[model samples]
Target chain A: MSARSWNLALGLVCVAFALLAVFVWIPHDVSSGVIVQERGQTNVGDAMAPTAWCYALGALGLLLVLTSWRSRPAAKSAVASGPRITAANVRFLALLIFMLVVSLVLMRYAGPVLVALLHALGANVTDYRSLRDAIPWKYLGFVIGGTTLVAGLLALIEGRIRTRQILLALIAVIVIALIVDLPFKHLPLPPNNEL
Target chain B: MTLSLYDYVSIGLQAVFTAHPAFHVLGVPISMAVVMLVAGLLTGLIVGAIPALSGPFAMAVALPILISTFGFSAAALLPTLAFLLGVMKAATLGGSVPAILFNTPGTPDAYLTTFDGYPMARNGQAGKALRVAQFACVSGDTMSDMVLITTAPFLAVFVERYMGFPEKGALIILSMAFIGAAVGASAIKGLISAVFGLFLASIGRGDDQTPRLTFGIPDLANGFSVTVAVVGVLILGEVYQAIEDLAHQHRSKTSPSPVVDRGDQKLHWHERLALMPIIGRSGLIGITVGALPGIGSTLAATLGYAIQKRRHKGAVPMGQGAPEGIAATEAASAAVSGANLIPVLSLGIPGNVAAVFILIAIDTIGGLNPGPSVFTLNQHELNPELVMVIGVFVIMMLGNAINWTLGSMLMRRLGVLQHIPPRIMMPLVLVITVAAIYLQEGKMTSIYFALGFGVIGYLMRKMQMSGLPFVIAYILADDLERLLRQGFSASGADPWFLFSSPLAVAFLLASVVVAFTMSRNPIGKTIIKNADPE
Candidate 1:
């Protein structure tokens, strides 16, 4: 697709979202009421500004679609139809998403230790090599294991831990523990007594 | 308007000599502000010479540290703000050093400087290019600061005295419309993005009285954390872009040609005289754009260059090697640094990420509120906010003076060729950003918000969206909503309350005219055209 088509598609999406926000997301009471008399309801019962902004966005999207469509036939091949999604881009994106999911899932449950491990490993993903090559594994397992141990011990000693090392370790632990706790469907949010 | 020239001078003297004895230090006798300015300038020179650590990025890293170290009250004091302002100026100056020597601009604004800067370097005038850049940048920035010293407080006082919530609301809307029309690919796209920002900001319940867009999520009851959103979207998104570039580089097989040249960096009096017009013209252009919400230094640099090129009539050969080109671009971009504060200090709208970070630091670390309140004079107790505001102007001049004296000397030591590998720096930056976010909010949910926003920011970057307007909208969303709501409440829910005041009416009308006119091609081609990406 040309840039115009892409813009049109984006415009359509904006229209849909804006319509939903204006009509569905805003509370019915605020929209219906003449005066919002509730405590701290400074608008006294006004929800129009948000709804007005949504309508304006909807209108803008419509205009964008019209303009882009009008320009579409003339929009021949150009140097910049925006960035293309190459295989490398896809791989980089996938790695990022994987890291994100892993970090989020592990952040609450395992906290510091696991998260650090993931980050340390995740750092290599930018190189577009194999996951192993992304990070430095040249030092072998003992080196990794020793550093991980010292990192964990330091976190344990500090009553209020906020280091990156602690962050990664906690993430790693939680992901592992959650896999083990699949049947129970329960997880502890870091520094907790639950196993 | 009310005060005499003597009263103003008296207040200025008092602000310097006796406002706070705590500021007194060293033999020079200015205060901690001098120390802060020197420290900030050195830090800026080092950081800004690195392509990855631009002024805004450095500010992002430093903000949490600044706040955490200084605490709220101490952070608001003259020294800390002065340091931040100093860093901002020096960073603008230092960006050109790398741009000249390595052809890798330290910041986006420096991208234009490389058009002539690199050519000059290739011509064996690397030191001269650096010197020209330093002089133009510092002088231009100093000029803008002087303008701010006059205009910001005047505007603030007017707003405090005459504008109510209704007028304020109208002004914010006007600002939004103007910024939206001025930036992005198109006015429609800009407006849509801004509205989207508002929608996103609508999420969360803050304090006790506001409505929450939580959608029944317990974790989101407190709203998305600003620290997370800012860090994730702005800083981490940049990291992702860098990583993406790395991925592409790994797939390609190419080698870079290294160029080496150095000389004595000194400026002749005649050269300085020759470059003054270009610097002055570009400075004016930069200050005009910077005082508004959306237009940034990149555009300013481009416009300045384009105009100066036209004026020169090809006498100096623009892209091949021209001192005028370097001067025009550097002066405009650097002028923007000081002028960017005009809106933030007066109207409370941050034009770009740097201003956003500054706003965040001021709000978090400084107990004082910005906007018209800073200019409000207490008839009873002599408002400290006003005193602080004036002191801030004084610190800014001191920062500019420091830049004039020490900036080029510091830039010489930055070693532009000794580029830090992204592989080494990117990971450290990521870790620092995450840790900074965690420290700022002290909540796990805040981390989630940051990560989530980071993803959004990354996607937006890939999609060719300008983050400036979105950030501006997001930052101003609460203020806009609050003002509108307050206006409605005060007017007993009257729908036309915005038209009640002449000021409000004027703002609304001006907004319509500006937005419509700016959206047109003829005007857009005239005003607010951004430079093409390198």
Candidate 2:
């Protein structure tokens, strides 16, 4: 199939999706069913109405389809010179995509350390000759090491603070009672556990 | 809201560009604005010299977080804007360094410079070319900055005094149509990309603040963050393209070209004087085209080169190391950097991708909306935005001076970056983008959105579609919707409301004509231009 054919398919897909969004997916709010203002009912609809946008998108998609249909075929050699199903390019794209997926999933499942680790691995998968002799490894190591140590310390402090905050309730209550309640009977009774 | 012209003048000048008494040594005061302007200029000189780190790349990496820092206050954004302006100007000049030294144009506008610039390099006049380019670029930028200062206020004043939402909406549509028309030949493809962006904008919320298109995804409740959308679609997309190119080259076994350098070159006063006419003429042309929305520096540069090619017969021959060619191309392209802001400052309509980013920054990050309101004057107080623009103007001037003194020194050292391979650089860029996206919304979920858009961007590029219109359309979407809503709402939903105003009718008609002319390009040239917007 030609590029025009591919464009046609894509344009059709876009039009279908847009139509679905406009007619099926669009939700109605409390006052969406009516636009009557005589009874002092106004703005009873979505603040960012998508109807106009949806129709516009659908029209644009149709135009794309027509454009693709009418698009002229270029020289065969030019088309041949373009990106083909080559192993090297495919592998490169796959690796990048794989890294992106893995990093995104790790973000959902693990802590920042895991995510950072993945990011480092992803960034490190580059041309060896381009980096090895060009950059000073000693400097890179120091920068990387210093960054890791600082990040680790900050994370550790933050984790401790987060985990310990609510767990200190009993000590807080005891201290509060000693300072104020123990001195007098009718001292505005500190709200019990709600405190 | 009324104020005297004198009050306006002082407000424009006093907003931070002037020295403050924060610190003093022997009664010499210092201000952050001047310092920031200098810093920004140096940064621009450095970053702009690198190949493939184009305007969108710079803006995408910075805008998301930068918005948080100042939050749109004119006084604070002014310093940052000064620095940003410096970066932009320097990019136009610095891009030529690689074009001259290694035959690599850093930005689309720099592409034409390489025609003559690289020849100069091959002929052992690389240093001369760089010097010529530096002079031409800065002169062009200064010329356009003057135009912006003189024209923007008058336009804003007119808008403030007269027009309403309907007229603004028509003008915006006119601009958008021109954008679709200006980028490449296919109005269909460009419009398609734009519509896709608009559709993205429409998703996530309804007019009544009800959720739509969220599909019950909790993370998407607030919709895609601007940072995710812009960075993913623009930066990450470029990363994909870079990686793809490297992969192809590696498989094909293409060797990197070795750069040639000749030492000790100086441009004399005689040569500079001879090239003055070319630079001046190109600067004029650039300002004229730059004032129009959608047409950008890249186009301006190409036009400048073509015009000069016809007009002048210079020493060393045209396209064979001619300094006049470099002067014309750099002058015109760099001029657009400042002139691009004309519509943005006056009507809040951004003309190109860079302007779009700035406009978005103003709207989303800054509290003040652009346009006539920014120029508003009152009995009690003058508009701070007017003052801010003046500060911006001052910063642009300072930035130019810094670029002149510092740009030449930095040009020699730029080749150090040429050693970094795309394989290493693109991935690192991706990592930074992911980290930034995560930092902004504090969610891993938005990274996924960015990743998805990145794929779309890669596909758009591979399919030979211009990604610029898509990104610009996305930025303009919110403003477009707001104006459209206001206009339609006030007209009681009458479709013919726009026809009520003569300016509105004129703008819409102009949009139609411009789109028609732009969309009807020769097929081959159109294909080439399609890839140029990057």
Candidate 3:
């Protein structure tokens, strides 16, 4: 892609975003007008700032498009390298998102699943919420989820996972938990507090 | 009741010395603030020595945890601020270790250090180069702090006495415009980033009864967490980029060769004396550049090194094992740590990423506000904010003192830390950041928000957009809006309130001029091109 095309694409995107904000989002979302009068006092409303910014953004976008359109292309040797979003970047992002989703799922559900398993085994167990601050329960989800995320990312970068990497990930999670949990007695680890 | 100047100083000293004692060491009582300062300095050194980690990254991760430990009380403010100041100071000094020992720079500003430092290391003068850097860094930082202490109060008072709402609003517009224009490759894109940040910042509850731009989502009513968004963009965005870089390197089966250390790592007294003049000139340049918003230390280091190189009469060339070169770059880069706070203290405008975090800490901790009001010396009443500012000054001095004594020793020992693979460190950073946010907000939503912002940060980086403007704009958006509204109301509901005063109009015109000039040829792009013509 050339610089001209890059600017054109960026301009179009910005203009689209600005138009949507001005015409659709602001109208549907903001309850107040650009100027509001209440109790016989007139004041700038919440919509005014957002509306101004949107119009400015739109104008700038149009300016960018016009400039890119009017400007001549640089000589071959002087042409600057344009920004590229490669297929590898998409792949990496997709894998990262997948890892994050899996880790979050484990973080949110690991303790509850454990409690349910114990209950089904005829052992007395309370809900995860009640035992969020208790021993073992608080550490379970964070440790499992955190380790998975860390190790998964490591594997993604290294192209393979090893036992040493898993061990390192687990140790890192436990150490982080201790650092966060021990210093402040009232603060609960993640997902546990959510529960 | 009104307190004397002496009384305010005494109160400030007491805040740092006697407020909360963590323990006693050899019949001397150690305050929690002191302990945390030392802890933060050590952590900063370690973080800064690592190639992929930085001071801002450490500050971002440590902020929520520090807040949680200290809680939101007047007493908590000093200790939290102290730790952050410590990190800010030490990290700059520590970043030079990798630059000197290996060819890798731990932070962007340290890239200049490597030009002379790596050559020195390869030539068996690594120890001496480190010593010069350490000395130069500590000296420069202390000098910058002295300037901040002397000038900030007067600047703040001036701003307080003269600037009204209209002027203040115009100043913010000028700041955003200047930042947008100066920071990145394209001024239009940078301004767009700033405006977008403001737009995002507007998506929560305001003074009005109805939440603005929430789209009726319950979660959006409170708006995005500033901490989450900031960390996501600045730290995690970098992490994502690093991970991708590492992945690419892995596929290419290319790895950086390890550097071996074998050098006369010692600086004599005469050598230190010789480098002082260079250090002074560079420190002044750093202080000047850092006082301006959005022009960061990279420009400072480049100007410092270039000027010194032109004036070089040393046995070794400036770029090849010249002690003067190391001293000049290190001094200028380190000096920026303190001088950048000048704007934050006087105008309540953050000039850089570190200042942004400092402002966030003050806002989150909620006892102190950095602005002209902070310097208001009430004749008959005790101004606690003034005392806090003094206390901060005390912390900065302490940080510099520690850097002088122990920083050089730590820098030498940290050469091994440069070997930590980004592939491993980045993942752990991601997890730790997530956990930190979760611990602070105790909500899954905040984590999700942080991740979302992290993606934005990553994309922005790929597109060559500077995140500093976006983050600063986000932080300042509320203040800008408030000032605008106040100005309008004060002007009898006139829509042209921002243009009412000559000073305000001048500021607006300057902003437009800066935007147009810088858009045509951005200083950052020009400096980088000059520094590395390849």
Candidate 4:
């Protein structure tokens, strides 16, 4: 697809995904309503209050983008005169995309080591200079070794005394949260102890 | 209404010593004011120096935390104001690292710095440029802080008498026009961005529970956060450029080396003394522009750079690694950091985005109602003038002290980043950014928001749009809207009343003149010939 089409398609897909997450995915879960109500009361949501002007502005922004996009000439070829896509740029981009994806994935599941490995592999594949040097063992070892050392150091540091204090602080936060939640949670159906 | 300087000093001392223990701890007490200013500055430097972390997001996250901890006192208020001021000064100086070393601007205000700073880096003048910036920033910031302290109370009185809603509204409108005219390569684009910002500000809920434009979703009851919108558009927009970069190849092997000389580049006595004159002129530029509503440090810095560049035309070009360039830009931007506080403290009107978030800290924790009456009386029976004077003195001195000792040490470390590959650095930057967001709110969502905004910010940069003005506009949007609405309501919806105040009218006229004068673009050509008198 053309770059313009690709950008439009990707942007629309992102918007659609956000909408789906907000509406369908959120409402499907039985606990989502409770979460929403609780969140609505939070300071973050309080600041996120909806206004009529957002929609108006969003529409205007859309119009402006479309107008600007239309008035501009079709995309000038981004592919340089040398090659369609250089190996170096590909490596850089691969590494960038790998980091982004791994970060989001790490937030949910795997630890830093696994994420770092994936990033290294991505970097390796995209960074290879010539076809013959695509998987240079020495370079691969360097990327993997360097990434592991950094990740291990971080994990170790996070296990230290300072980390323990931070965890304690987190626990205190949770306790306070539960204490605050208790009255609100039990307010609707309390007084009788049900077995 | 008239508070003497002695009243201010005595009251400040009383509040610091006697008001409450929360305002102090032992003799070297950690009052809310002290905490606020110090924290703001520290956070500003940390966040701004980072590749992805930005000033607005950093400030937004810190304000709530400071409020919860300090619980509003005059003693607390000064510290928070100082924090923001220090942060502005530090961030402006800090952005030079990425700009010079990586050709990437860490902060929006540093974009122009990249133009000259990166070139200098190629020529191995990174250390020199950084040193020049540091000296300039300290000088400008000190002067601006003085201006704020000396003039805020008087300005408050004048504002109380002359500035009703209509005048305030007119001023905001005029500011929007001025910023739109001043920033970016294209005025049309700037205007479009501003209009978009104003439209975004008007979103969410209107007064009196009227739904202006929210769709069916209950979450839409409050409009999308301007922070979200801006982050999405500016940061995320910039991130898109990276994606585009991915589709191509980078040929950076021939890029400039990073072996800069750490030689005897120290400023001489004569050189140090020479800065006094440049500092004064640049300080004036910063304070004057900072006092205006929308124009901020970035523009002030640009004006300073442009003016300084005029002085050394034939002998040395500015964008080609002129020390004067670094000196003027740093001083003016830093100075504005201090001067911007004047309006915020005196009139309760935040001069920029960072200042607006600061208002939340002042109201929630400092227990001070900002604006003209702050100079008269407060709910706490505290002397407003006293708190202000002392706060300015402490913050300004502390800011300078911190810069002199600690700021340089930190900057030296950042200068080393030039050697690291962008491939390694970019990912690490992203990782650190996520950690910072998580630390700020302990929420995964803020990280997501930050990532999303980073992309937008990147795109905005690529489009050659001035993200600073738009961000400033977004921050000021609500205040401007409220003033405009209030002005209409109070004046029976008569548009003519908007220009009723003579001073406001005169200011608006002057704004027009400035806009016209700057729009001509005559200086770019004449600056060279003027420099080469022969």
Candidate 5:
């Protein structure tokens, strides 16, 4: 278990999945109205003070993962034996816990062709044991023909109609969140002339 | 200071001799040698022979695989500037192969190549210090890509004729006084991490009206994403200190040895022309501290190995072995890898930290806005000389052909990176940095504001702070608050008209004598008292 108790249980499950996406899966907006004149009617994503600074940095990364899982140290004597682990560090820790469970389960149902099939499963986990003993059906045809040829060529260049690859990946994520929200558009200052 | 030096030297040499033509198949230049030099030299030898992967995680998985290979032609913008010049010369010679066999430091300019590359690999002269760090990283990155194609169009026509805006805000206050007196271990914690990275680059939402610090997170109204805050403060704050130093360390069972004395000793061409005058004084202090942003390439390879150990007064100085201390710290951090893309290719100024992800991939998929009119605009009308001559010959021949073919076969396959330990590589680089911050905003609230700036970049690198001058003053704080609110509405609010020109009164008198000598930190205790001279 130690590897700092699986990195303090994967940093306390990414601070309990960022405190259930800041208190029970996001959804706010009860007319901000200056966060209901200082914290009253709340809920506009809990009167968004950066969702309580993302639950105060996920409760300071859950108090540095419960003080690095209570200052580990306990196993100071036990596992004296050797060689038991290294099958290339358990295939690089099972390709780093299957790329953190395939980016917490395929980033909201396949966005970047499951992030380029997690970079072709990190180049088949750095030649997964020499392509699983050289061309064993080309490592199951590169994990079923390289993850269905990178999710059918990024769902046929994000189209072959699955609601046109989820409406062109949600209109390429609302035109890159409206060109990174163009300097947070307040605009009005000085140049106002009512046209 | 309206100098326009002949329209900044005829539009910076017609933006480096307008090159284009890369696409064509059956008839070569095959996508500029398979997507800019063989898939950027196999993503710079698997992110520079993986420590916990580097070269900004092969530019955050090659910028959404070149933003899903955006519409070809205009010579597929020279394979995204030849995959950022083969991940900046295979992450600077694959960060001196884990500072020569696992002392570790895959890149923070190979932390002074683990002080003389692990004492010349415990003196087995690790393949003659990895062939003298691949001939001083391909002769200091082909003499800093021929001085960034002949000195960045004469320093962009001398900063467009004697620069202004108080000498570009005293050259970002003397590049945050040489990144807070040359990086880390305190220059008042690197000017309080470049004033907390210019207050997180003046928190998003600003084009004007006013909301200065979006503490009211409207998904930081397009604020963050300086390539997701430089892949969340330099690769998700080094995967939260390699998952808290891989759960305070383990994996031992000894192996890394393979010393093979490459046919017994070689170097002497008069000991490699006496380390070319300390690799031309650390490639002129790595092209002037890599054209200064938040002074990068690990403080230009620790100020070019502290001016080649104070110009070698002789006696075996520079951390013991000295092949002119690995050719002045690998030719001054590979002469700021093509002079840190000459201010992100002529003034869309993202000076360092991989020119802030190649100025957010030439403003998100070369739509453009990298400054001095991305070599004079004309967007859909196209021809900005096809992305400034195939982004300068595919970033100087994909950074010297990935330093002459996989830079010495990824420095002799750096002992299969000690069987990838860091507890299965820090939760697989925090699950590919949460699928690159949800492919840059397919929001789970931008993965909850990138796990709230990955827990404020892991408590500002566990309080030692200095997240390289707060991620280069929060990626140039919204172009320094929209050029200080368009120089205070074109002058009316005249704070002495930001010091009436003369390059903004010599950048407000050298940023008030470098903010009064970096609020007296005395060059971080004289570079850790001459880097541990003990």
Candidate 6:
């Protein structure tokens, strides 16, 4: 995208946010007025600061739009092409988000799933939360989730995964889990606490 | 009934030295503070040598663990602050290692070091270059610390005596404006980032009974954790960008090769003496720039390098293997670490990212607030906060002493760390960051919040916005609101309280002027372009 278009897009987005904030969000969300009258005394209300900032943002956005519109694009080559969110960047962001979601799901449910699986296999087992503090049970979700997060990211970045990388990732996760868990027995790692 | 300054000094010294000994060395008992300081220094050296990791990242991860280890208590304050101060000081010095050895800057501020350092490495004078950096870094840091120690108390006292609520409010505004204007490429965007941060901060419970902007979410009522928001934006955001960069590089099949040490590695006494003038000038420049709220070490290093380059008459040109070049950049950047805290110690406003963490540590630990009140010397009694400040100074001195001795030697050997691929390190950092946050907050929601902010940070970076302004503004938002409310009430609910006093008016006017001027031609962009013409 050209510099002018980039500025234009930024300005429009800012203006849209400002409009929503001032007209919709603040009024609908905030319970107080810009100024309040209580027991014969006046005071600034919760909405005052946000409202003022919204106005300022709107003005700045308009200014940005005007400046970009007024400026000529003849010497575009001279101007530095600022940071752009390319298609590749978007794809990378999507992959990262997907990886994070999957890892988090595993972190939140891996232990419980394992416990249920054991129960199905004719083994006596209780709730995962009951055994969150127990050895191996506590480390399960964190290890699996943390390892997946690390190894998956490494694979994403390196464009390939090796067994050595997976092993290293597992070791890294276990070491970190131990470092947090050993000294501070009170501190629960990740999904253990949540469960 | 009143103790003298000497009495307070004695109290502070005793407090720092009389802590529970971690161990004894040759009949001498070393306090936990000292031990932590040494540990933090070593960790800082390693952290700073890594390409993508930085001092703030180390501080962010250490803070939660430190808080957990040393619970909220007066006794815990010194050791915790000491460890952080150690990390802050040593990281600046350590960052020069990669810049000098492999030409890849370990931190943004260290980029200037590459101008002269890489060339020195190519000339097989990498050892001498590292030595020059070490001496310059320690010397400049010591000088800045001296200035901070002497000036901070007096400045804090002055602010306490003279400044009222309106003045304080205006001062914060000025700081926010200055930071926004000076930090990023576009002043408007920087201001927008800061305001957005302020808006986000206003989401939680305010003066009113009802929580603002919560949208009725139970978690929103309590507000976003500062650590989660800041660490997410500063560290995770950088991690995300770095991951993308690595992926791109992998696809392109390009990788950086490591440089090996070859030649003269020692700095002679005469050579060290000869480089003193350049170091001194750069240190002064750094101190001046750092004392301000928004202008950071990048500009300091740039200005230092530019000024010295004009005056340089060495056989090798400034950008080419000149030891003076290395000295100038290293001294200036390292000096910024200490001087940057001047505003934090005196005015209760964080001047930079490191100062923000220091303030956060103080807040989390529940003692010794950084402001004019901390420096208020009571005639009838000894001020404990003042003593804590003194203790902090003592810890800084210890850090510098360590830097002068072991830090330089450790830094010379950190060349191997430069070879560690970012592809591996960044992912590990992401996991460590999440785990650290989880350990601290013990809430999965905090992790989610952090990742959410991390995405925001990544977007902000891609848009060329500096996260420093956003993070600083977020931290200061509560203080700003409190001051504004108090100032408004004190003026009988006058709407123009911020502009009521002469000092307040001056500050607001200056803020506006600065925003307008800097918006047109940002100082950061100018200096960066000048530093690297290509």
For this target, which candidate reaches the highest TM-score against the unseen true structure? 3
**Once superposed on the true structure, which residue ranges of model 4 sit more than 4 Å away at CA?**
A1-195, B1-4, B10-80, B95-132, B210-212, B225-251, B254-266, B293-306, B313-326, B346-366, B377-381, B384-393, B408-413, B419-470, B492-534
User: What are the per-residue Cα lDDT tens digits for candidate 4 across A1-195?
Assistant: 343443344334334543553455423421212112233242111112222223333443444346445744444664122112235534544544455555355333332334356568775333212221222221232233223322322232233335543343334333332332243332111000110
Can you tell me the CAPRI class of model 5? incorrect
How do the residues B370-453 of candidate 1 rate in per-residue lDDT, one tens digit apiece? 877787655555556666777778777877787887886777667543367554355445545554554455555665677678
Order of quality (DockQ)? 3, 6, 1, 2, 4, 5
TM-score of chain B of 5: 0.34
Q: lDDT of candidate 2?
A: 0.66
Candidate 1: C-alpha lDDT: 0.68
Model 1 error, position B292 (Å): 2.5
Candidate lDDT scores, in order, read: 0.68, 0.66, 0.85, 0.54, 0.55, 0.84
Could you tell me which 10 consecutive residues in candidate 6 chain B have the lowest summed lDDT?
Answer: B525-534
Error of 3 at B390 (Å): 0.4
For residues B182-249, could you state the per-residue lDDT of candidate 3 as single tens digits? 87667777788888888898898577787989878788888998898899888888888888888778
Candidates in order, TM-scores: namely 0.81, 0.82, 0.96, 0.63, 0.30, 0.95
**How well is each residue in A4-44 modelled by candidate 5, as lDDT tens digits?**
45435545655676566455443332223212222332212
Per-residue lDDT tens digits for candidate 6, residues B1-534, read 878888888888877777678888898888888888998898888888897788888998888888878889988888998889988888888899999888888878888899999898877788888889899999999989999998988888888888899988888889988887777667777787888788788887587787888888888887899999898888789889889988877343454455566755779999999999999999998898889886778778888998999999998988888999989988998888889889988887887888888988888887788778787777787789988898889889889999999976788789789778778889888998898888778889999999999999998887777787888888888888888877777789988778777988999999898877865565645742322110
Between candidates 2 and 4, the one scoring higher on DockQ is: 2
- Candidates sorted on lDDT, descending: 3, 6, 1, 2, 5, 4
Q: What stretches of model 3 exceed 4 Å from their correct place? A: A74-81, B251-265, B521-534
Q: What is the CAPRI rating of model 1's predicted complex?
A: incorrect
* Candidate 2 Cα RMSD after full superposition onto the native fold (Å): 11.8
Q: Tens-digit lDDT track for model 4 on B335-410?
A: 7766777877776656566665665456455456667766674444655654665755665677787776677667
Q: What is the TM-score of each candidate's chain B when compared with the real chain B?
A: 0.89, 0.91, 0.96, 0.74, 0.34, 0.95
